[model samples]
Target: MATAVFPYLPADELKKAEDESNARELSWFLDNLQEKLAEFKHGLEDCYARLSPLEDPESSTLVISTPKSELVKGHVTRVGTRVVKGSLHLRLKTLPSLHLKLSETSPLILPQLSHLRTLLNNALDCVDITRWTGDRHSAAFITSQLHLLHSLLLEAQNVLTGPSFPVPRPGTPHPLPIASRTSGEDGNEHNPPWYQCIPDPNTFAPPVPENLSLHLIPTTSSLILTIRVLEPTAVPPSAFNKFALAIGAQRRLEHDEMDGVFMWKGEEVKVKEKVRVESGGDPVLLVLGVKLQSLEKGIEGAMMSLRAVMGLSQEKDDD
Candidate 1:
């Protein structure tokens, strides 16, 4: 028999090497876990700050209360070194609620909250990572608690900022200047061509007796007009066959169909043609567009003229 050039390690030595490798991996996992926990803790604090003002009873204007009658309760029990049970109650204002269960055994005793307020206070407090022993069980338990607390804080923030909460009323719409070309023959800043044209609200007429309205939105390159019919009824035999829209004489866009876009000076406006008549319940959506520069050059007068053609505006007879 000849001696082997390479010899296999004994079973005991092999097992020791395997154990050391696992220990190193576990240490890396614990470090990562601590970092994640710290990040979550910071986020929890910020969310709680945003929600705290609404929690004050004196801040009635900003507060939305969930009724006690709506509260739903759930419980989780764990049988381990020592039996532990936890209860959670949720009061939800909207449909669909939340439920949670905890089954893992924790190495350290977990904190208990007497009520929602206590839970929120605890979540807002700094997480003490010094107590974490870098053990897998401790990491799991801490992470789970942080996640639950984060969810609760998020829910509180949502409730505080929800649409049901009262908000300050908005003021009147302010007119914004049309976007102008920065450098062009027509765009001399010192002696710029008169391009500021405001739409005469007087001449602005929507489809009458048909529950139709028109809204204009101005952009950097063009003016967009949206036409909507609030009510759709069956089209009468005398319904207008074609819908025409124009902004500042750049070009007239005529469409007999339900929707189309009109282009002018490289700018486009869109409009919907179909009126929601009784047979067709779909609301008429017509979008139209025109170049912003065209609008600056007294294009509103052209729009008024187009309105007259569509029977949307009547020219006052100069008596």
Candidate 2:
């Protein structure tokens, strides 16, 4: 009598209903999980991109606020093809600077920019979405992965602005040595041909033929100086060389033999004394100085020549 009142549903119908329910539940879970994951991933990607030197051709600036409301500012400027200038303005009064030049063997460990873009499109390749039922463990695992990604981004930033640049860690395997392992023709293992062991200067020095130029832009109350290589692509691995600037009758305004270039404010020009110029005569001369060893040929003074034209217009008294 009970069986007749409640007829049994067919096995196929029961199986179909169960599958449909599972599909709906899985879809809803994936939607929520993916949304969260995507938001986190986007934030990390943005941070990575902002700090990546390769992504920024002009410059990359990052300002991170601390818990104490202080700001730590950092910037990386591409000076040449192989050279990059970095500056960090910490909470302290003094600012630190870094000059990095990538060599042929240097490793740019920051992964390609597209790595995170496709992370979600194929992230589930090995993941079984059906098994993820919004369990606490599953959520925790996702969160861990996001944290790892964030850590990687932070590491990249540190590599750029850290006190020291990244170098190959010891114990890494090296290619086979070109020198003979056994004794040389001299029958001495210690004595190898100079050519075989001599380090190449080109490996660390600037290119043989270099072209550098300097220009000045005058503002309302300041002067902006810019130095750039004409052939940036040809520049080899090099350090931040020195520069000297002279204004008005070859008077040295600023000079540094070993340091990175910094933006010079007009007030910091440090003029020794005021020059007595003829009221209606030639303009003052501005000379761009360079080290003799840095260039093969002397740069034409005319190339960096700038005329400081100062004139006081006299008004006739109107009666």
Candidate 3:
């Protein structure tokens, strides 16, 4: 068979490949819920830099936790892990009576807790991760959903106090900026011949937490990489500079060392990154790592959006 051109794979096949990969990855997370839970628990402790005993309050049992907000916050602890023998320092603001009762004496609710735990574990096991795809957009979607859920769970915990805080006053309803050309979904970075419009030099990323990572490994022909991140509300200024530098360096290397004339901003970065901002705050930064390489023989053309070729299918499937 002739050499296949990089980034020139057919659309249908690319989507299938990405779908399978996403399914497998998600399945892995589900299969080893305990391990993931452990990883998350350790991660939470590390990020929060606090040793508060897993915040178990009375009248309510802590079932599980996930990344709580845009900024990395909490995680779910799986049962069977060594529970520190000492008393946890969880203070219950909602019901001090219940809190004291539970802590002073382990409540009979252990059974209830165990039952809910079993139910949750089973639900995760049978979760229809089919709702997810291997595409960057799908990944972002899942990350966003998880983020929102985390926030809601925390809010619910606080609200159980029965209006301790002032009633929230109604405010102007601001519509989300999806309509603006300025704010686009991270997924649309690969719109074909128009892919130029997608953010190049842009990382294919979900919202990223501080602990999550984005890495790029350059190959003779293409880049290989892994990105584990949570979604961000907006891009930081330093992140923007890093993106500019990486794209510039890559372009210089291609031109100076490899005798290539590829378009860096045009092909390497998404057009959205170049979006002209007319107001508000600086745009939210989403980071993705790109691995680059030259196309091989056989294919007459090569097309790269703001993401890997395998990413094409992911984008489509997400839509």
Candidate 4:
């Protein structure tokens, strides 16, 4: 019996079994493909709905502000990646009290916008695939495409709520903020936008005075306004008085509110805003301790001669 036994199988029967197995595999793959296709279809529909509107131009009021100050304000009308009509308002005290009003009608494009949008659209283009053979490779392709679409979709959503900033107006001597800006009228090579007394803002902190540390982060999100006020125990000494940089002294008095004004650049800057006068005729403290202009219009204007400053690089937008 052992000698008669053979280890071989019938060729036709083996082939038939293989065919059935292949059929089952193919069927399973088709089911997986269908699920993937349905998911992709729904996702694509949603992505297009959001992205399509961005193609059409939109205009917005862009404000670059900090937790306690407004650094820049502008009216920007954008058509896709570049500003079609816009203006930048900058008030640097080193200048001769001139608020830089850089107006732009020419397009000022950012390189970032172009690259990001190109990547996003390429994902959209992937929808028109040559073919998927309903195999493992096709599944992988579908997975990769869907992953890309999902990633960009999330990134795009974060961009809609803007933390705005002032970009340089096109046609200026320097279209970028960090670039050395020559006076357009004078065309002098030696004259930079900032004054001689101040170190280049691109490299060093501006000439802000001591006592109050003026740190302008200049990144997308940071600015320091650490006011060095005297502690309450130290307030009575001759070195410091009730009014001079007293810590927590400027807390708004809980009394009848009054309006006041201080002069800046020949403009009557509004002050004493939301601050109530104390019962003893003591000057009500402001949100600002020693830094008086810590007032809204003041620090916001960054019109501070000794005040702090901050800014964000203007971001490129695809619409």
Q: Residue 197 of candidate 3: its Cα lDDT?
A: 27
> On residues 1-319, what C-alpha lDDT tens digit does candidate 3 reach at each position?
8886587769898888878987776545444433433443343333222112243321111221112322111111211211121111112111121110112222111121232233333323322231333232353444443343334323322221111112222342122222232111221221111122222122222222232322211111121122222223343436765787778742211111121111222232211111010111111100000000010110112112112323445466346
| Stretches of candidate 1 exceeding 4 Å from the true structure | 1-7, 54-118, 129-319
Better candidate by lDDT, 1 or 2: 1
Q: Candidate 4 lDDT, tens digit per residue, 1-319?
A: 3562255558887778777876676456545555454444454444333223243423322333222333333333433444344333333222222222323423434223343345446544653451244233443454454445445544433232112332333333222222232212111222112111122222212222321111111111111111111112222335443455367644422211112222222333221212111111101111111121122122123212111111122241111
Task: Give lDDT for model 3.
Answer: 0.26
Best by TM-score: 4
Off by over 4 Å in 2: 1-8, 54-319
lDDT string for model 1 (1-319, tens) is 8784256778898889877876666556555555555655555444333223222321111111122443334332211111133333333332224342222332111111112234345654525532253344453454444444445554333222212211212342222223542111123322222122222233222112223232222111121222332222233222223222233423222223223233212333222231111111101110101111222122234333333432343444221
A best-first ranking of the candidates according to their TM-score comes to 4, 1, 2, 3
**All candidates: TM-score:** 0.25, 0.23, 0.18, 0.34
Clashing pairs in 4: 250-285
Preferred candidate (lDDT higher): 1 or 3: 1
Task: Write down the RMSD of candidate 1 (Cα, Å).
Answer: 30.5
